[model samples]
Target chain A: MDDLRGGCTLELGSMTSALKAQKILGTAAIPATVVKTSASGGGRGCRYGLRFSCSQMANVRMILANENIRVREAEWKDGS
Target chain B: MEGRELTYLDNAATTFPKPRRVIERMNDLMQNSGGNPGRSSHVLAIKASETVFECREELSDFFGAAGPEQVCFSLNATSSLNFCIKGLLHRGDHVLISDMEHNAVLRPVYRLWRDGVIDYSVFPTFVLEDDGRKTKIIHGILSKLRRNTRMIICSGASNLCSMTMPLAEIGELCRREGILFVVDGAQCAGHIPISLEEMKIDALCIPSHKGLLGPQGCGAAILGKGVMPKTLIEGGNGINSLEADTSGELPERYEAGTLPTPAIAGLCEGVRTVRALGIERIAEHERELFRRALIGLSQIEGVKVYCPHHEGSVLLFNKDGIDSEELCLALSERGICTRGGYHCSALGHKTLGTTNGGALRVSFGVYNSSYDVDKLCEALREI
Candidate 1:
């Protein structure tokens, strides 16, 4: 997921769930590469984006949506 | 402490009117051996180096570290924490931190989290009260750790308000879980008794200028053998300058460049002062001041004190209609040096439900007396 659109980063509870999200999206198992930036431009809330798989994207979006994040296009240099 | 022209109450920030001996020793060092310690082979350099070693020895004994070499000096708590946390943690590692943490811990962790370097989790230690006093327990923090939780960085005492963590319990849990534990003792070093062995702490970061009553710009991290971090700052360690690259070893591994010899010399004196006065005595003295402030704060009609049920100088509150800043200004106008706002502990304030504007924080030190606390009470009453 390159562009998280209106989606925000969810505070997932455990490492297993976070790892599962990565596996589902086929993204890096760690969220370290993702950059967090607030849409407000005032730097308050946070959103994330990176490259991943369909299952991973769906699971991450579902988790984000659960946390009130609205999914958008995965922001990447090349849309695979 | 009473009837003084200026009453200082921001010891949680940085203590003032350092012990006379601390100042005297620093002055003596500056006058006599102004040599670069751990560098030259001259007697003056050796003497200066000896001062560093002796101070480390005293600090090791003070904190119950395994040896003097385990104590590594840094510029301040922030620097020490950077050495302890960032140096040890790698990408994908999971870290658990308490809700009550200063920016020294929060900034580093947040930066890493934002950079996508590690998985971050916060364990709540909040204890809610009817009167707006939020308390937290250490057990709440320990119970939430998962198998992936690799490290735990905690504040020994809340900076926003004085709430001492169940350090022993948390340390034990970390040991049991095989998690690295780092304690930011900025507020507890000289004001409280911290035994590394008794606490089973992996690392203890302390600010020399705060509780230790040393000059500004001096802090240290006491590392246990179990905890070793990759170097954050690497350069000549002064011990092995003949080598092209820096050596990797205790104390030398973390410290780089020229040493803050003067500040450290002052810290040596500060440690001696703490030894002479005894940290237990200091704790007892601060408790008296805290008790007075708590009693007076309780009497105030619209004030709410935020600290643990135990004794300490962390006096946190918000008045009926006054903002934390306004109250702090009001107290300052009365010649009381108290800290307002989040105290660089935004996470702490958030967990305590005072994140909007934070709370007015008044921390005490050994130099503080019952009279200084009384003055704070009087000011709060007027507000």
Candidate 2:
């Protein structure tokens, strides 16, 4: 994971959304993990996303976009 | 009553002897992963959340929902109906319900009407009539469609009798009229086939304990895509913590409190059992039992079976010169389980013209057989 804002992390809306993304990624054989973002780390108080490797960033973005997930490019900021 | 076998014919109330997998899954959840689902990020909490979400996905697939997000768990079918009828209806909106609707549908709609928030019409289900029933029902609904009619609520199958609502036809009518179609699947979820999408239903409310063969205390309101209703109740869904409003997600938006994870886990397994056994097989089994009961009861002197030609899972009748409740008590004394009286649907009683005294109901489950049917008839004859 590289150091950037939402770069390696896919900012899905909720835990359900993140789990859905994980399932989607799983079927494609892409690697992802459900991570809870802290208030200061991601965009809001409590957010969930799929944290993946920096190298898979482009593929993650492209695949999720195809599935209408609408994830943004950001860094995997560790929660406080 | 000691040491005697219980016939257990009141499945319309709640099923007894749930599937083995259902009980095992619930026990497994409580003992192993009894954490708050979607609340914390701990190991047990994550397991609970995953189990709950898996149930959501399983139900969504079973009911033909768009995705797992559409199926929201609740306490039971009554709460789910309240959620849909209350959440979906706006001020001044008109709704139509079938005459055979249970109190689950009638009570909430009555409250909204009493408060002057909305008005409703009761269309005839013709639940007792056999000839041209579907066409008559469709015509009845078309006649009752007001200009502001927003939704049409009907049961996929009646709780009182085996007469089934023509859900596909009613769904098509609602679609053509641009009204939401909601089906109360409390009596038919596992007994008969239902597809939310193919039937054009906006929402389908089902109870886990009844036909689905899950334990009591859980049900769901499965929504179709783009049918988001207003929240009937609001609370933390582990999303949008700081915000005053709840999360704007499919299930979390409606699911306001901590979900009944154990019951949901059980419901998931229950639906799996249904899928493995095949709903078609279950439907015919009940129908065959109903046919035997119909013949057996009809052969008895002074016995009457309502809607005898209309066959599914439930059958309603009463004996001549015998009080309905007294008959039920006598049957109970003989180790037979059955229901009597209005069965909580005044509308249904009026429709069936059973206002003097309500009929006795003997409902069947997949576990029932000709022996059970014969036993019921034999007990009734002795009574």
Best by lDDT: 2
Total backbone collisions for each predicted model: 12, 9
TM-score, every prediction = 0.78, 0.95
- Candidate 1's docking class is incorrect
Query: What TM-score describes the B chain of model 2?
Result: 0.97
lDDT at position B379, candidate 1: 80
Model 2: lDDT equals: 0.85
Off by over 4 Å in 2: A1-7, A40-44, A70-80, B1-4
User: What is every candidate's alpha-carbon RMSD to the true fold?
Assistant: 20.0, 2.6
- Listed per model, the TM-scores of chain A against the true chain A are 0.31, 0.73
lDDT tens digits, residue span A1-80, model 2? 22333336666766777788888888988867776665532444666677776777778778888877746444554341
Measured with C-alpha atoms, the lDDT of residue B326 in candidate 2 is: 92
Question: In candidate 2, how many Å is residue B220 off?
Answer: 0.8
Query: lDDT of each prediction vs. the true structure?
Result: 0.73, 0.85
Query: Model 1 TM-score?
Result: 0.78
Clashing pairs in 2: A4-A75, A5-A74, A5-A75, A6-A73, A6-A74, A6-A75, A7-A73, A7-A74, A7-A75
